[model samples]
Target: MADAEALTPRVFIARHGETEWAKNGRHTGKTDIELTPYGIKQVHTSAKELVGAKKLLDPARLAHVFVSPRIRAQQTFHLLFEGANSVPDESVTVTEDIAEWDYGDYEGLKTAEIHALRKSRGLDAERPWSIWKDGSEGGESPEQIAERLDRLIAQIRDIQRPAMKGEKAADVVVVAHGHILRVFAKRWLNCPVDLPVDMVLPPGGIGILSYKNNNVNEPAIQIGIALPVTD
Candidate 1:
């Protein structure tokens, strides 16, 4: 069972810890910020339980660690592997591909604020605005998001392909923002970028992605995994 499991690859997606803008329901794209004190503490707690030998994100099995090019996500990744020794420094890459969705016009504004602004501009009269569907004005469109994510997906698959043959490390970790990570999950399953992605990932939350039946071509989301609850 251990060897069989080793033959399969998994991608662990972790949303960055909360920032002030995040707690206040701001769009927070391209505005780099650090995690709050409470956010840092919570991520540390989660790391203690979720990362280690035989844990969900064992450093021993990690092939790569992809982090968003944002301060909050960088902090989260640092805290996540604070005392870990097996993770090689060379294996980690900071990438813009996993950064938060570029909410150009909506940056630092809440959903309601965005709606009101759009309405004031004579937009969204017949329908409410949705970032997933309409994307942000003056920022990345759905097609742009899909293009970057597809490039990332291809890179990850190339790294994981060797694992299918038991040649190298198989597991990978992605530390990024809420919106982009959600899109990453959806895109991993080859879902259309413009469709509604009905999913919620809280601050410092963790989710898993793996291949169906251990086949690299069949990607699927792992919906359930046991982890220690932080009080």
Candidate 2:
């Protein structure tokens, strides 16, 4: 029998580079924004070290890629594969299912601002606001986010299952926003979206997901793909 590790496939979740709103710590849902100049530099550096043959995300081995409809995410995806000879257009799917969390009335507000707005509106008076639990006012609930992400996750698993048996290309990539990608990681492991995800995906950051022991039934976060960069 072949090694279990060799047969298992991987899913790479990449957060888009920083935008002005992101750098300002504002809620930027439904606001199509471009990556900042520094943000472009961040992704260019990331692509240089991460995407290539024998690297963490070899485009040649990439089976498919799901990208957010947001401009920042689209820019990040293009930058990640800028000169890579692999990754044809047919393998990419631009989707809203992976877009940033809808902030609605709280859009463009920071966490403290959101709390103040909620308090003034007589909401969350008994407890502090938690987007994971309370969700944004006039926006999507945890249930709605889970519904869309679940559908996408199901599609990804269907594609990955065959690859786990060595029947096809194995690597997959998702380019999206920070909050949504964190929720995605939780959903990939069957965790409830209403609870705190306890994970952070910084701008231009990358994370991996895969099945444990080569068993597609057991999805897990891959923790040791690369060495941590130190300044």
Candidate 3:
């Protein structure tokens, strides 16, 4: 019999390149930001990384490439795909489920400003990300985002499970914003989904996540498909 270990799927994730707000420490939810010149180059490099990883991936087994609808994510995938060795029937797909966290009342505000306001209310001003439950005065609650993210992952898994079952379809790639992607990771692994989803996207930092024969809830499930940014 063939190795039982051969029957698992892999998932690749790519974070979009640099933006004006990304350069400075600012909240970038729902903001349509463009990639910088450096970001363009980084996406190219990341695409090559994706191609290199194809050595382990079966073309027939690769289900599909999923991406957030945001322009930055779209641009990132378009450019990276230019370097991919193989062509897929359907390339980039967008999911509203993967959009960035809604900051609501504090959309474009800086952390410091938000902190001041929260401090006036005697809340823990240092825990900006911890407010997922309460949400911003007018933003989305963590439970809300987590619920949607969970359903989205379920949607994706349903689509891929057929291929995964056959032994050829085993993996997919995704391009999306930082927080949403990270939060999606939390939800994908059946975690609490309470994390700030703190991830740093350098130009076009590329990472990989997997659901093969492992516990998703474990803290160490985030293994590397490509070298993660060390900063």
Candidate 4:
């Protein structure tokens, strides 16, 4: 068994790099879109800076990776792991559970456009539209998203708990979209979905979640942004 301190497990959430719609603030859910040339470059840079020896996420410690099925997410995952050593192809799983929120009727629309549409439809005139509260119509509700995320969080804990006992390396990486990954971070801390998330996840950004006190009961999201490494 490895030392318990050395075996503390972590979940690293990496948001995919920019797409045309993402750059323009459009709601990109369930849409398969490729990363822009700049987005590809951004993720490659992120891979070099954040993943490796003595970096934010050591590749050797990574046990598994979950990625969204979206093309942008897949592309970002590919670029992010390009330089990683000994990461097996089977260890990476593309799962819909981590995919972006199904924007439904709001899909492809920017925030301002969605707001205007809601106003024209006489909905939520008194309060600004919040995906956290109301969710996207013809799509998932907050409760639905919460249920799935809660399940995934539990599964992550199950995978990490044994590692905390020093059985093996248990760091897991999730590559996905902005809103979903942000929500995952919030839920990792057991925060309510109705609460506003002040954390900002830029394109190709990486956020860390791990146990405090080396116990599964003390889950917390690490503060401070992780910047890309320059070569």
Task: List RMSD in Å for every model shown.
Answer: 3.2, 3.4, 5.1, 3.4
Candidate 3 lDDT score at position 105: 74
lDDT of each: 0.86, 0.87, 0.66, 0.84
On lDDT, who's better, 1 or 4?
1
- Candidate 4 ranges beyond 4 A from true positions: 1-6, 83-86, 224-231
Candidate ranking under lDDT, highest first, comes to 2, 1, 4, 3
* Candidate 4 whole-model C-alpha lDDT, 0 to 1: 0.84
Output the worst ten-in-a-row residue range by lDDT, candidate 4.
222-231
lDDT of candidate 2 at residue 47, scale 0 to 100: 89
* Native-referenced Cα lDDT, model 2: 0.87
- Native-referenced Cα lDDT, model 3: 0.66
Shift of residue 81 alpha carbon in model 2, Å? 1.0
lDDT of 4 by residue, 16-130 (tens): 9989999998999998989999999888888887777657777778889998989999888888887444379878878888999999999999999999999999999688999
| TM values, all candidates | 0.93, 0.94, 0.79, 0.91
Per-residue C-alpha lDDT of model 3 across residues 43-113, encoded as one tens digit per residue: 87766544544354334456777777778888887886653455465644677777778888777777787
User: Which stretches in model 3 have alpha-carbon errors above 4 Å?
Assistant: 1-7, 52-61, 83-91, 120-133, 195-203, 214-222, 226-231
By TM-score, the candidates rank as 2, 1, 4, 3
Instruction: Estimate, for each residue in 101-130, the C-alpha lDDT of model 1 and write its tens digit.
Output: 999988999999999999999999888988
lDDT of 2 by residue, 44-118 (tens): 888888888767677777889999999999999999987754488999999989998999999999999999898
